[model samples]
Target: MLESLKVLDELRLNFSQSGLFILNLTLAFIMFGVALEIKFEHFKKVILNPVSTLVGVFSQFFLLPLITFLIAILLRHYITPTIALGMILVASCPGGNISNFMSSLARGNVALSVSLTAIATLSAIFMTPLNFSLWGGLFTEIYSRTDASGLVRPLEIDVGQMFQTVFILLGIPLVLGMWFNHRFPDLTKKIVVPIKRLSIVFFMGMVVMAFMNNFDYFKAHIKYIFLLVFIHNAVALTTGYSIASLFRRNATDRKTISIETGIQNSGLGLVLLFNPKIFPPDLAIGGMAFITAWWGIWHILSGLGIAGLWGRKRKRVVTIQ
Candidate 1:
């Protein structure tokens, strides 16, 4: 079992230049669609109730990273170092693009969710690099003493390069989308939905295609990865919900915060892992690859399932009343 899992550490996926371009474009499109849903009024509203927004931010940025490191410490004996770092990377990332829709589905505060998304994403531009580097360095030190076969890469990040990528991919598209939406509200409403649907389909399809290409390898080794991601995601959701409850937030804010915390931008994680300049193909192969890729798909399923359950429970309570 150990050896089989180790094979993942050396197993490299084929990534073409055209594929990288497509992936970059797909992520930019997704970010743009997410931006289309944001409005200046949403920021104003978040500022109006700063407590909930602050709590959500704390849960996502600081609390999540702290807990993720704890989780890595606890699991260090059981899992490879690379796998634990993958969890850290995902935890450090911002909220997923669909968080607002999921929050609304769960009858949560949609505007608050959108506001958190905007803040988290912008913050992630800097925080992601910082958090990943710090936590990843710690993981490396601990693992170096524990295991001879290193499962992770050198913990160096080019801050300037990362900043440039985030600015182009996330910031530029966001600014453009916001401007377009503000300029043509009706057209924005009509096309935003289609853009979202198409981008999600394209993104997910490409991810699945790449993973499925090595079906046998991944199939043989997905059990442990799945279990790790499940636990990590649970921790993330609970952190948000617990933090919000401590602040005495309402039920809607609690749900929104929980969803925002749970659904990370694993897509961004994947892009970073795949970036030749960031994590080399060899260093990104096993635990990192599996964890982020599985996370990309699993979070959507888990988020929707949780939201559906919340929706159903709320409906039942209303009916009873």
Candidate 2:
């Protein structure tokens, strides 16, 4: 498994500067769409009823990264250093923009979901870089002592560059979208749905293009990647639910918190990974790119699958009652 995964360290996906620009635009547009759902009331809701929100924020920004580090440590022999760092990067990302949709489908707390999304996205500018550097640095230090191969690169990140990228990609769009919504309520309502639908199509197209370009590498190594991502995603979802439940959150909050924590903004991770300034073209971090890209696709499937089950179970209970 480690030998197969090691090949990813030398691999580089075919993505042009133009393609990268488009991805940045698409992700920014998606963040804008997410902000359309964020009313001032979402922040107010979090402030007024902070328990569930606090639980979700804690689970996402803190516990999830901690758990991922522990998982990487425990599974060190089974996975490569790059793969482990990839998991850490994904964990450090904020909740996916689609989590609100999944929460609504699950009959969970849509308001809370939206609120968490807003908070998480805003928080990510600082937290993503902080968490990744903190955890990635620690992982490399610990792993360096165990491995004789010297594969682990010094985990260096330009915190200023990352903050700038995230702020541009997330913070600016968020402010603009919310302001547009606030300024033109009627127009915001008319365009939000179409913008969101278009954003999803564009993002998925990018992911498919990435896969097509790297089909051979993915085909050769997807089994290992698949299993790693599947287990990692499951642990994330379980951690969210278990923590929420431990805090005595109700079922609705539990479901929403779980979805929020589990569905990470891996698109952002991909964008960061592709940035020459942040990751640099010389870095052998293809494993991080693969993990981030696949997580973008897999989380949607897994989130929808779980949401569908929860939705059906709710219908059944209602019928029984």
Best lDDT among the predictions, by candidate number: 2
Q: Write the per-residue lDDT of candidate 1 for residues 1-321, one digit (tens) a residue.
A: 456666776677757878777778888889999999888888898778799999999999999998999998887777777777889989988999888889988999988999999888788888888888888888888778777765434566665676677777788888888899899999999998898788779769767756766778888888877888899998899999999999999999999999999999888887777677776554545677788889888899999999999989999999999
> Please, what are the lDDT tens digits per residue for candidate 2 over residues 1-321?
988898998887646889889889989989999999899989999999999999999999999999999999998888888889999999999999889999999999999999999999999999999999999889888888887865545676677898899999999999998999899999999998898788778778767766676778988898888898999999999999999999999998999999999999998988888887888677788788888888988999999999999999999999999
Candidate 2 residue-wise lDDT at 289? 80
**How big is the positional error of residue 230 in model 2, measured in Å on the Cα after superposition?**
0.5
Pairs of residues clashing in candidate 2: none
In candidate 2, where is summed lDDT lowest over 10 consecutive residues?
149-158
Q: What is the C-alpha lDDT of each candidate?
A: 0.84, 0.90
> What does candidate 2 score on TM?
0.97
Q: Give the CA lDDT, 0 to 100, for residue 47 in model 2.
A: 91
